[model samples]
Target: MEYHPEPVQQLILCCSCGIAIPPNPANMCENCIRNEVDITEGIPKQGTIHFCRNCGRYLQPPNYWLSCELESRELLALCVRKLRGLSKVRLIDAGFIWTEPHSRRIKVKLTIQKEVFANTILQQQFQVEFTVANQQCDDCDRVMAKNTWKAVVQVRQKVSHKRTFLYLEQLILKHRAFKNTTNIKEVRDGIDFYFAQRNHAIKMVEFFQAVVPVRSKSSERLISTDIRNNTSNYKFTYSVEIMPICREDLVCLPVKLARSLGNIHPLVLCHRVGNTVSILDPNTLDAAEIQSAAFWNNPFSPLMNSRELTEFYVLDVEPLGPTRGKLMLADVTVARASDLGTNDTTFLVRSHLGHLLNSGDHCLGYDLTTCNFNNDQFDQLDAGRIPDVVIVKKHYPGRRKKTKRRTWKLKTLTKEQDELVARKQDLKRIEQDYELFLRDLEEDPELRANINLYKADDARSVMTNGGTDMDETETDFPEVQLHELMNELDINDEPDEAMQ
Candidate 1:
């Protein structure tokens, strides 16, 4: 059997352009069909942009605010991304044209290029008008509403001091843990943090656990319920309690604890430095470091706070090393400003401040000898009389003044702002590195020749297209020779004596 070729049909004329073309659905040529089919069909004539007034951020769908400056390329990109036309065409370039000065409306000109057929490129330009709308973002809205929290974290310490809270506040700020909190309230001896989610409160509790010794307990209350959908919403609260004892607090240990600790001394001075808590025996000069679990199990009540400390005149001093000190007492009459008595008393001084004290220097310490004993000590018979004095810190005679407490506040940066700053720095560094690379390329004759070869090819193409001038300004990025770059890196990677 012989295969026969089909007869060819006559070409038909395009209805719109009156051009001869193959029969098709619209009976129109490619150019005529393209002209009739609007690429900007689904494109919006006007677009609405929601922005935050206070922070100057654009609303980026759902519940996020983007740090986009007004009339910036970033802002324009965001607006263009929201357009429906962006999804259909391959965007070549976009530019913004300002019509009225200080107006919220912006005219955006977009150039899109698409390949409708093989080796056939179609380029089109369209304008999109934008209108700015003022709307607060989710974060700002929550802050303004104030009652939108779903959880609360109550941080409390049993001690009657605010130093722990102050320290915790600094830690929170340093770690940026408080950024998740919606609001913070200062209480008498603690702080209350309101959060938009329960996980945020839990994360904060975990943060405290990592940094300090904390005990946490959680409770939840039913806020609302949808019986129809069998759904329930709850508000959670996490109670985090810190250890009672703080740094430089004079504490008396229980008899059982004293015996368990090898009968060092019932009179213990709490010294908290960083995450470690040390119980210093003023008499034996022995220090025992206790973990959080052990400290909580056998807690000691503070007999004297650091604020109740009084200044004592050092009549005589026996020099010890940086960690230890001994003192000799004389019958010198010293005026007692703490109202214990004005008498000549002889006592032994064992303190960490021994290295810092001189014969005439005054030190701030607690007079534990004056404390009254209770039944807890009498039962154990372990309430031995404490030392006459325990030096806590070196006190200057004329340096007595009210110490100001540090104020704690949360310092937070928006995610967009942080990203923007990082991007700017990265761009600057990239620019610097690129400039150096370009200079290096110019200095290297071989690399420069390779780049010129590429430029020559581009110039030939322009000339073939009947264009005389090769636009240098249009070529922002010069082609780099990859093999040359690799060779340069290999040469620099050689081991040197200085590196060794």
Candidate 2:
């Protein structure tokens, strides 16, 4: 039947160009159709991407801050979503074109297909150039403007030194616990963290509860109320008080509390302070943990801290071999460093740090022979029950040597100082506190495990001069191993302006 023919299908000339094509909508040749109907007509060739320099986040319109890396899928999607006329066409492909990172420019190449007339589909590819314009985000603006906080966290510790605060600061830096804070103010006794939202402050308080033995209490004040909308705004304040006891402190616990902790000695050394106060009897090496609730119920400040430590020359160390964990019972002969040249006086005492002491090595201990105690717990102890000297930690010499620059460093948060002008004494105090922190890191293996240490950019400089990162002649402190440090590029998820 077909042999009689479907009348030879007629071909139509292109409307714009004299080209023949099968009769269909948009009767034009492919080149003419592409030139006449552009699928990317309404899309702009250039756009602006709002960026927050303070936070390193891109502003998605309508007040949303998004964190996306350059050339990432999330960033590409965000860039495509910024285009106005893309909805009219079917998106075929979208990708990023590499450009100078510091140039603050982003180029996205887009391919789209759209139907022009009847079955004629037109596809086009074009690039959109986006220039980053710095704009302060809501959070950053609040930080610049004082007193814009909805919640405040005041961390206080009634201590003479800032050693505990420094430790807490390292923990916060390692965990990024201050990420949501709008402002961090260093106060006289402690730090104050301000947050735009109440939940962020709550999370910080919870973090403090987990990291340190602290008692926290919260209070809220009504700021404004809208009866019509059934809405009310309240400002919240969280007060966190850390336990006064710190690492390497001497404690004279109450008789009742001492008996409760497995009948351990009341006279103990603060081994390490964390969520709980860990105390070890220097005589017996008996360890116990004091919880936050228990500590606050009957809190007592340390009788003496590391500041009271006196250097002693070790004359002898005889290990009795009664070991508990890393500690061993021993009879130690020691003379005060000050008395070594003048007198022949010596004291024999039982110590828990017997395994770490050498005959010629110097160590720090608490001298109770000449000191008088005023505490009720100490008064209750019989004079014969108290030891003459309590060994605390081994002393490392050569700290007086030139302060060689470090090969590695830690990252700290940007904080606001409560003091408008730092006094010389304050600066000196800060330096001393930092030195103590460094010594703690070198002496205590457990403390170093909780923090992230990054290799500094000038790490190779020290090696070039000293033949090693930390030369034996330069410093006697234990070297921080390379395996414990992380390369900046390996752990950096956010884009740094300096790097860009």
Candidate 3:
């Protein structure tokens, strides 16, 4: 209103750099003030990291936990990434000072460079502190808390044996298939795996499908619902049933099924030498594999098990032909253990222990004559009244005394024994594969060259005398560097196209 220009305002100079700037409380220019300001202003003095004591993993954000051998470095990186000051400054390098084991506090040295002014960059070093908090991750917490699973996988086989479950358990452990499983329970005929997520259960089912022939059915139940938040929680159950047959069992095939299977045999022996079940004609010594679909459509029932086996004494034996590896053909005259009379049955049978059998030797076999034949008319007609013996093992007379006959129950490996054997076999196979891989690496020219290129100078010198050094004659062409060698021949290179 006075229309008067204010008296000429006096300009002040920066006290530190002697630069003229607007008057302010500090009497410093914009550049000087900016340089003086700390870029870590909004950063927390003490950062907390959630650590899972159970699994020894550190929590990343949003319900994710990372597993690493160097937990401290991982935690430090995660905490540094969460700092708000990092957005304003350019980080050059950062390092953590060593702290005592189990220390709550961590110290980090950060070298940050910031462009406070045009064509002007300022670099500074500062120390930031972090606090480690021992807390359970979501998975570990769910595992610790009972009955907190989001999905349950019930692995079962309809057979009376747990052999398939045992094999599945070994596969799971060897491949770490159940890495996300929260709990495992050993049921009567199978196993139950509890997972924290439905996807994990699905992943497990997929693994089963890849390795074992399985059929799965899934169902879900509503746990809770939040109408306001539009969220619902559910618990899922996946029932995965494996094949109902195992190795070394006597199964009766229907007449129609036998005809479908190339009229092989009605009274077939189930021998699971590999993944598939090979139905063998005990009389003709012919075999045919039963596929998953065929087996599911017409599943064979076990007519007799190993426990129903009895001993027989060989009266006379004659080799019919040349041996076929461990199997051979022989005409064996044998009498049952209960019958020591001169009446002995002679059978032209395929025997695994034919070479070891001599006159008067005792052997164990399943008595097919006593098998119940109700609906299995084909077996009743084909194997009726004939004391055919499927030789299993050799027996000694010095063993324990025979016990009284009792009711027949299915024979199966106990849980402990089966698991132990499966684990051992899995480990043995892994070791053998590893050894074969090492041998191949040593023998493969490209792999050997690449390995030599990465070896330390001292190791190379030591290996030179043994003629195992990298091919130095190719130096004229090109001295293959480590990176080039890696690109050319990787140790984990896939199989050749022809092999695939």
Best by TM-score: 2
- Candidate with the larger TM-score of 1 and 3: 1
TM agreement with the true structure for every prediction: 0.59, 0.81, 0.55
Model 3 regions lying over 4 Å from their true place: 1-49, 55-103, 108-128, 224-233, 273-275, 311-328, 332-348, 352-364, 369-375, 384-387, 393-500
| lDDT assessment of candidate 3 | 0.62
Worst 10 residues of 3 by lDDT: 402-411
What are the runs in model 1 whose C-alpha is more than 4 Å off? 1-48, 60-69, 72-96, 99-104, 109-126, 133-135, 273-276, 291-299, 321-347, 373-375, 378-385, 396-500
- On a 0 to 1 TM-score scale, where does candidate 2 land against the true structure? 0.81
lDDT of candidate 3 at residue 17, scale 0 to 100: 97
Write candidate 1's Cα lDDT for 1-500 as tens digits: 99999999889998887978877766667777577666667779799988778667787776556775556878888888789767777888898887774687878898887666555556788888988889976556656655788998888877644555545654564456766667666655577888888888889888888877767889999989999999999999999878777777877777777777777676778755345567877555677766667767876567777657777777666644434324222222222344435566655655555445666666678775666655365345444464567777555443212111101112222211123324765556434434433433433344334222113223334446542333343232233433332211223232111110
Stretches of model 2 off by over 4 angstroms after superposition: 1-31, 35-37, 41-48, 53-135, 227-231, 400-404, 467-476, 489-492, 495-500
What C-alpha lDDT does candidate 1 achieve relative to the native structure? 0.62
Each model's C-alpha lDDT?
0.62, 0.84, 0.62
Clashes of 2: 0
